[model samples]
Target chain A: MTAKIALSDVHKSFGTKAVLRGVNLQVETGQSLVVIGGSGSGKSVMLKSILGLLTPDSGSIKIDGRETVGLARRGRADIDHQVGMLFQNGALFDSLPVWKNVAFRAIQNDGMNESDARDLAVDALKRVELGPELLDLSPAALSGGMHKRVGLARAIASKPEIIFFDEPTTGLDPIMTDVINHLIRNCVQELGSTTVTITHDMTSVRAIADKTALLYKGEIIWQGTTDELEGSDDPFLNQFINGLAHGPIEVEGQKLDSAASPIEAV
Target chain B: MTFLATIGTFFLAFFEQSGRLSVFVGQTLAAMLRPPIYFRIIGQQIIRIGYFSLPVVALTSFFTGGALAIQIYYGGNQFNSEAIVSSIVALGITRELGPVLGGLMVAGRVSAAIAAEIGTMRVTEQIDALTTLSTNPHKYLVAPRVIAATICMPVLALVADIIGIFGGFVVGTQSFGFNAAIYVQRTINFLSVDDVTSGLIKAAVFGFIIAIMGCYNGYYSKGGAQGVGRATTNAVVSASILILAANYLMTALLFSA
Candidate 1:
């Protein structure tokens, strides 16, 4: 299958600190790729680079074979219009109501009618299992789970060809996490959209990721299908997935007790 | 040697920051001229940055006008020249105090609010979210505030000019035993259209200054809450200083003859 999104030798750095040394990754059309990494492992940076929020220092990022790195506002805007992102914290506009927040891209970019946009927003929300009763509610009024649902609704509301979910289950409980994971799976299947998700939650990784990539210290050390992920023998992958502190993954260059309560196993 | 180096570094930082601010202003102006202007955001900002700032601006101008009248009278008492109070107050209110004082007061309120709100958005990734939605933050957020403040400032200054003159009038007639009709006539006669117009011009410029400073600081704010707090302070301080400095330059340019 042709690749919907492709990155080759992507490198980005801020000042002296290098975030992405050389991240070469490719997502096939209609594949869900989850990138799992530690706190400072450049997962967010990689996502931001693709979104054009942060420019890479070097390398090629191709969406449908068009090089996207360093694209100007107009050029990047055309790409952004076809892409939808669900931020780690929902990132809903507090100034707008739930409907307006969901229909933001439609009303703001396409100049769609407000009534029509709201109708579209309601349809998207319903797909996320949210009823029309929450349309008027503010983002702050919703619980963490509800917020993620609304965010999912907004992300898919525009019917984008590519959707990104950044740590979709960071703060949700187990049941809600499963709910979000299920929603993501259904959304991708229904739309047949290429999906990229960055998350550390193993349960989510299994539920959502068709293919899995492990990013550590600005490099994708291991990538394979979810079934293959279990049989992989990469030390970095083992330490991260099993929450082992003593593996090759050094914390700030200091070796810690491998037997200690592993950091952020969730 | 260390102190000398420190002084050199400080000057270099100052110039660098000033240069950055100049570029930011140019970008804001360019974005404003481009299409896809969000009229709704502009209206909301007008209410937030201009209309909401009315009470504070009015209060400061009123008090300053009355105080100016009192000070002018005291200074003129020695020469039995207190009659100049009405003329001078009207001139000062229309030409300088109206725009300058109004600008400063609004700068404190509007600049801080804009900085805090936008800075929060920046930290929370809402600004980046705007980009992902195909909306330029400059066009959607910054331009609207700048345009709203620019359009609203002259209007705010006009209101301040009237209220300030009235404050002076109240003090002159009631507090200083001046004839009300004579004071009103003198204020009307002494104040030329050019004087009010120049002040309004300054007001518009000041409005642009406030919005630019606020947006620049907030947009560039890093870190988290502490960074946002710093941006809020810098916005008020820089906008206030720029207003005072620009007022002097504009006054020289307008009335040098």
Candidate 2:
């Protein structure tokens, strides 16, 4: 079967700093691919490039085999309609009430009536185990965990075919992270949507990922199933998954030899 | 050689800035002319940018009118003081002061508010969310604001003109002891429809400047809270400067004869 999303040799740069350098990725339909990387490893940049929030300097980004690179906002409308994104910090419109924020895509894009949109929002919230009482409340009233839940609700509300989550469990408590991770898995399964989530949280990666990819120095260095991810002795993968201080991973412009002892490398 | 390089760099930067602004203007105009205009958003902005601004614009025009009367009476001889005060006050307020002052005040208030709101939205990635939701930020956010401010400013300036003329009338009749009827007549005789129309035109342009500057600065805001703050300040400063510059250009063009 054709991949639902395919990125090949994607390169993006900001001035002298190259964020995404020759990133190659693929996600089959109904598969959940989680990209694991350190902060500023160009994970977010890659995600943005896929979403058409940023255009790549070179290479092709295809959605359902359609070339999407260099497409203008109007050109990407059909693609955007089938995509949902949950930002790192929820990114809910603080000006809007909770229901409005959840129903924003339905009402604004789909031209659904306000009443029906509210009903859809209620249903989406329920899927995330949220009650109707939070509908009229502002996003400012929600706790951090509640914010992630609401963000997830908004992302899955329209039941788009493709969903992207950016650091979905960052800043949340352990319990909340697990809750969010499980919810993301359940939502993706329910919709049978292709998902590409970017995060460094191991617990989240194990809980949510069907296949995991390791990104380092702006490139995808490793790709495997979660079990493979855990068992693989690849220096980069081993160093990152075990939270090691050394083992061929560059730190502050210094590269640690994989054969060297962790203490000596440090 | 160093001085020449500095001058060359300045000119290049100036041209680059101008080119970017020209592109922005083109995009805004395209967004405005497109379908899905969001009339409800435009209406809300009209109330916010125009109706809410009445008090400030009116008060400024009133005090300005009164001050003009006092100055003209003191400067002129007794015989022509009443006519001179009434006529000059009416002309100045309607043709120049009313629209310019009201525009500047609205720029400070409305421009700053737009910048802060949009800047916060930018830093939070809500704009990106809007795109993901299949909505164009330019169409939904920027264009409605630009349309509303452009439509409301002329009306605001008209109100300012009337209030300002009334202020001059009160000062002329009460303080200068001139006949109220004659003061009103002289003011009416001196003020033509063209004078008011020109100021309204200036007001409309200034309104466009205010909204566009606010939207532009806020749209590109980055970093975080400090970035939002900087965007807000730049919006007000740029809008205010453009208002003054546009006013001069319009005045000279309109009254060149």
The docking category that best describes candidate 2 is high
Report chain A TM-scores, every model: 0.95, 0.96
Docking class of 1: high
Candidate 2 lDDT, A174-246, residue by residue in tens: 9999899989989998999999999989999999899999999899999999889888989889888888766
Error of 1 at B102 (Å): 0.6
Full-model lDDT, candidate 2 = 0.92
Clashes of each: 1, 0
Per-residue lDDT of candidate 2, residues B1-257 (tens digit): 99999999999988987898788888999999998889989999999999999999999999889988888888876566546888999899999999999999999999999999999999999999999999989998899999999999999999999999888888888887989988888988888999999999999999999999999989889989999999999999999999999999999999996
Highest DockQ scorer: 1
lDDT of 1 at A21: 91
